[model samples]
Target chain A: MGGFGAEIVAKYNYWIYVLLMMIGFYAMIAKRNLVKKLLGMNIFQTAIILMFVSAGVKHGAAIPILDKHEVLEHGVHAASVVNPLPHVLMLTAIVVSVSVTGVALAIMQRIYRRYGTLEEDEILEKIGE
Target chain B: MSGNLHMFVMAAPLVGALTVNLAGRASRKAVLPLVLGFLTLSLVAALGTMAGVLEHGAFTYTVGNWQPPFGIELRIDHLSSLMLVLVSAVALIASFASLQSVAKDLADRQHHFFTLYLILVAGLHGLILTADAFNLYVLLEITSITTYGLIAMGRGRAPLSSFNYIIMGSIGACFYLLGVGYLYILTGTLNMADIAARLPQVNGTVAVATAFAFMLVGLWIKMAFFPLHGWLPRAYNDAPIGAGVLVAPLMTKVTIYLMLRVMFSVFSPQYEFFQHPDVQNLVVWGAALGIICASALALGQRDLRRMLTYIIVAEVGYMVGGVWLANGTGLTGAVLHIVNDALMTLCLFLVAAAIISRNGSLAFDRLQGLYRRMPWTMAGFTLGAFAMIGVPPTCGFFSKWYLILGGIEARQWPYVVALVFSSLVNAVLFFRIIEIAYFRGGKGHGHDDHGPVTEAPAMILAPLLVSAAALVLVGLATGPLVSNLIAQFVPVF
Candidate 1:
């Protein structure tokens, strides 16, 4: 199975995650467009969420529903449960990322209102005033 | 909970931060005491935990009272308790020093500043106390998000900087989460102690190395380690003096502390090849370059605050170097330097803020006669400068002394040279500002208004003095303090 896992190789989701992360990071660093930066930031965060969800999935595994009868049994009793933990954790992270994004975009709107431009270089020029 | 004042102490400041926000609407004067009272309580709790650690092995408080693997735990070992004390102590001083600047800068928004400050405090407290790796990630987010907010509330351009900060900061946090996720997938656990226990069984795998790389890279980003420090200088430069007080001093130090913990605690030294000399060699070279290179970068800066911001980049090098030394002396020095650098950085920023507040800007030429008009402020600035230069009898000296000795002990000549070169560079960097403040910009103006210039108001001065006193006290008792508090906490790795 481990050998089979090796043979099955990388998927589209993994490629997209890496590409999206790099693009987001590049937009953040290279682009001087403030609005473009926010869009980039959101794009970057979405990639991580993708990574987490992708991690939880296997080639073949059922949803992590526990067997009800094995109440307090320990050693290897509940194998192949494909881990509900990552999914739960990722849910919280998504909420947080979204909440912060809302606030950031509002601030971006205010910045545009004040500066009359979304270009970072122009806003910086005005600030230098 | 008998002799264990640990829970309450850490909890109280956060409680104060939360409650003060709620209560600030009722009375403004009452707010300071409320916050101060909790910080004092946190300090007392730290001392109690210290006593607790000595008596009982270590106190662990799992959230929701569940078992370790299933629940989030707040562990108060000797190391965490010391951090609690240091963070609270700096926080107490900064909060007091904050009143005037925050009042002037934030005004009706005082409550908001305090709220973010407390939340940041809570995050720092959480980071130090949390026993679980995944839990650390959550707390790290809380800190980073609040830090962005705190930086955003500064005078101007703050929101822009904070926005940029969030982008970089989120990437760092995500990297950390990925690292933790990797570990969990490999080891089937998230608890630090549990991971340490289990890792030895599967020591030489590619998965663990990848996990280590992921975690280290994430932490390096947070620590604003040289190349990854793109977001830091502007964030510091743009934050308000009061908010700057907190972020500039403690945030990166906490990140560095966590890096050390991960390197030593989560992946034990003797148990694995995670602490390979190859990794240490790579990191130390990065550290040395950060030290020398960032200092050189600072020399080119024209803005006073921007220069200080670059110095922070250099200081990270100092601490990272000590950690990579892999010796008790160097680790102690790095740990000790964290507190020392905090004081030095805080002092420099406070003085620069005073200068900026006095003048309309922090341009180098605007600082002439600053020393004469604000003698006490200049005196404090002088001490901080000398300390940054690592002069004898200052806290900075001892930190450098130990780090250099570690360099010698480890037979790393380049690191020792980097230390000497950086010290010389810092002297030039800080004194350049002093010279401008004195010779070029020091001419007295025929004005009577204080107007956020001259010496800082009592509120700001109070916290400034408290940290300055810590600088001296650490210098005097360097031997006993680092041994009892930090050295023992040093992970064998």
Candidate 2:
């Protein structure tokens, strides 16, 4: 319960999210292929959704839905249930990410049809021609 | 009743998009009338909303009778309504101007083009009106995706450019979502006003600073601030004239408006992030560098549309720097430039479209004798170029005047120098085109006897004329627009 072990245990979720995000970001910028960049974008978006959902979790908390009998017997406590707002927001984010990936893939298909290659520099050379 | 007008403005374009899709691609005649009908309706609704704001100052309309921190709200303040008026006005005019180009450039894909165009319109309106932080991201993606669709429909090399745009734009949107996640975790509210009230208590935390940095960088990239502007020149150059006219005017300008909105409404003007001298210096200096570099890049362009896109990057620098100057005058200048730059860019792009439609090229070498070829379009282009150069009695001049005044007040000499230097660069860039077109590349040929003066069709020339005239009218009326519209709403630290 002391020093580095305690600190890592407390914030491991955030650490993982940040790590995944950096990997995605690096692939997006440093990769050569169009499909790889698209994958990197998806990974980046998924990492964000992960961060949001993790932020909403609480230890020893029940589902957000309330039971009438429990509410009648004992008043509802805010901390007893996981936060539902971030989850709802992330649902929309997930849908947006899906659509973005679909559109990106469609555009990549067109690029392939036009230029016959998916590499960044190769496409440029084709365009130059 | 006013809220109903606001709701109608957001809904009409969406309804039109669906109807146009259902009408089928065979009925090409039905699309333009339907698109124009919906845009006109939205324009009337937007005007009503603006009148309501003028009468009532600023107000909020809650959805489903639910209060803030829970259900979404539409905040129709002076700022949002002003943007609404500008967005709808430009949409209507741009759609009108698209009639000829859509037929010429996208003859077969007319129906699909208008459908996506209307959806992009609806998304922009929603983005400006929403009070929820999460809703803005949703609408931003809607606009961005529709833009990608529209831009990809262009003639050549467009697929590659649009794909590059998709990659860069997705990264920007993801960064924005990550920033919003940070803010939501810090304060358990999704409403902007609620977050603003709760933020000061946890002011200087690392999380808050990180959130600000993320959001700022994300928006800067989306707005194509200097270093991140790689996607704009190519994408806009390759896009069809119709989509280019609509997206070019509204996209970056709206993002700049969002930056101002977040600075004032979501983060409070007095927040330490804005008040920190080092942070302020860094942003202002970055904006300054952006101006010089973009202007320099523009000087090297041969294509007219590509050069105009670089000018957009430099104009973004103007607005961003004005806002970061952190004075009432600077904020006013920023807001004023948002309206003026939108009109100026619309005018210029419309002229480019007209020239391309007739002359079959936007390259400088092909533009020889254009002044005599299309005199009316050339006149409009002249007004737009003068505005871009910050000449007196143009709207651009007034905004630049206020920005320079703000720079002097803030003692930011570098921003002032960049402002003056960019102005000179714009003059040189624009006049070079003028030299080529008017003098026919110095051959001293009076008029080409073989080619007659074929002006653009009425649909195209009319909007160009109206927008060019509006630039001057807006400049003349800047006194009232500031005192009545922009001055009262600027955040006071």
Candidate 3:
């Protein structure tokens, strides 16, 4: 429990995900740049993928696939089957998030054309104008 | 009709979506009737299906004839059948509203517009019918993505509003997926009935709480409840008139239906049998605050579109407050209001679209003295406005009446006050615009930019008149609807 260095390495990926989500939220609310905000949103959503993947992790797990149905079934002395469902769900969510980001970027492109700047302050100023 | 009418009930709209998309592109000259014909057919199918449910009992269509737990189920229980009919009925009205609006604005993009509109309708139908949680999420995205494209077709700030909506909508979908994942991890099943039966075994598990919180936040975001509703007003206001007619009226509502499904069926122990008074109190408090704050906000808005947006937010509070009251009357009111609110909101937005079409825009200042010039439009708006405020001789009143009675039954005073205050606030908000429209502008004629703006074209007018009629009809015939349709659908739990 007191092995600090080992623990950090073990859950390093999760920490990175948290950092990315925070950066996105920070950029969304704090930063003035709209392109950067969209970038932040993309990073934020990808962070959820990290969360889901980490939840699926097992220390001594296989890829959760086998030729025989018996191997997939629960057994007394069976190797831990890696959870394939989260991986599958994360795949769908990733596609949706990317589609949303693509559309957001398109909107950002339009906003740039109409307002002439992607910075929040400048855009609001222009909208006011 | 055949006894196996459930298949036709659900599949007709899906086929219509496909056919409309195909026909719109292939027979460009035939877009109007092609789309309208499909919507009208869907209406008949939905109503016939509802009638079947009323007569033949609740129907379940097993996809590919696969049984539950191993495969998906599409159920048309009293509640689901009722919701489907309401949704399709409004879609029919919206199609009429969209006909003229789309023709005038998007002649170049007619096919794409109708395609997306019908696909959105199909997605909505799929959402209501699906008995699998994952299937619901799939259909939810189908509507949301299509909704983004539809809203972006608006002329003014639609692109921006659509963008904001996408951001919030993505967060919501992800939250819902997270909840579904939690349920799957705990129960090892995706089918809703299977999950409900299995949930009792793991009633107080941490997974259940995680799933509940995830779903609560997710549905709140999707339904645009209070603080989470920042995206709604702009999206509703900015979308093209036709898009507004479809998306504004249905989007939040279908999400509300999902929330109800999850509350009653999926998270049965969480909402119903567990008897979580604290959670109930929290929801009631939030809904009350939403009603009060939104009404206040609506009172201050100068833009007609933005004002309608705020009213939508407040009205969500009405439904949430009613549902969370957790009584027979409360549940019935909440469920019935889902239909009533959709029709009324559709009426208002369609009429607003007509107003927008006639004038260059619907800014408050521009709407003055429109009463004499456009009596029919004004009358439609008046009906919608009165209905929205929950006044008498309208279905809107019954929803509030039941909600208040439920609140009183639940020994709730603040919510009753919230309902009353919200109604008054909206009255003040809407009447100011009417007063300006009737009294304030130059004598004997209209504004400078819009020269002698008469009533809108029939395509727009027909749908609006239909929605307005539905509001009055539902209000007048509240007893039969409450007893016959809604009570059977929404149980006390």
- Highest TM-score: give the candidate number: 2
Q: What is the lDDT of residue B215 in candidate 2?
A: 80
lDDT of 1 at B433: 74
Worst 10 residues of 3 chain B by lDDT: B442-451
Fnat measured on candidate 2: 0.89
lDDT of 2 by residue, A8-116 (tens): 8889998889889998998899999998888888888889999999988899998889999999899899889987888888899999999988988888888888888
DockQ-better candidate, 2 vs 3? 2
- By DockQ rank, best first, the candidates go 2, 1, 3
Model 2, position B117: C-alpha lDDT score = 92
Winning model by DockQ: 2
Model 3, position A118, has a per-residue lDDT of 72
- Error (Å) of candidate 1 at residue B391 is 1.5
Q: Is candidate 2 or 3 superior in TM-score?
A: 2
Candidate 2 CAPRI classification by DockQ? high
lDDT of 2 by residue, B205-246 (tens): 998988887887888878998788899988888888999999
Where is model 3 more than 4 Å wrong at Cα?
Answer: A1-23, A54-83, B1-22, B269-275, B440-453
- What TM-score would every model get versus the actual structure? 0.91, 0.97, 0.91
Q: What digit string (tens of lDDT, one per residue) describes model 3 on residues B320-364? A: 888888788887888888988898889999888878777767889
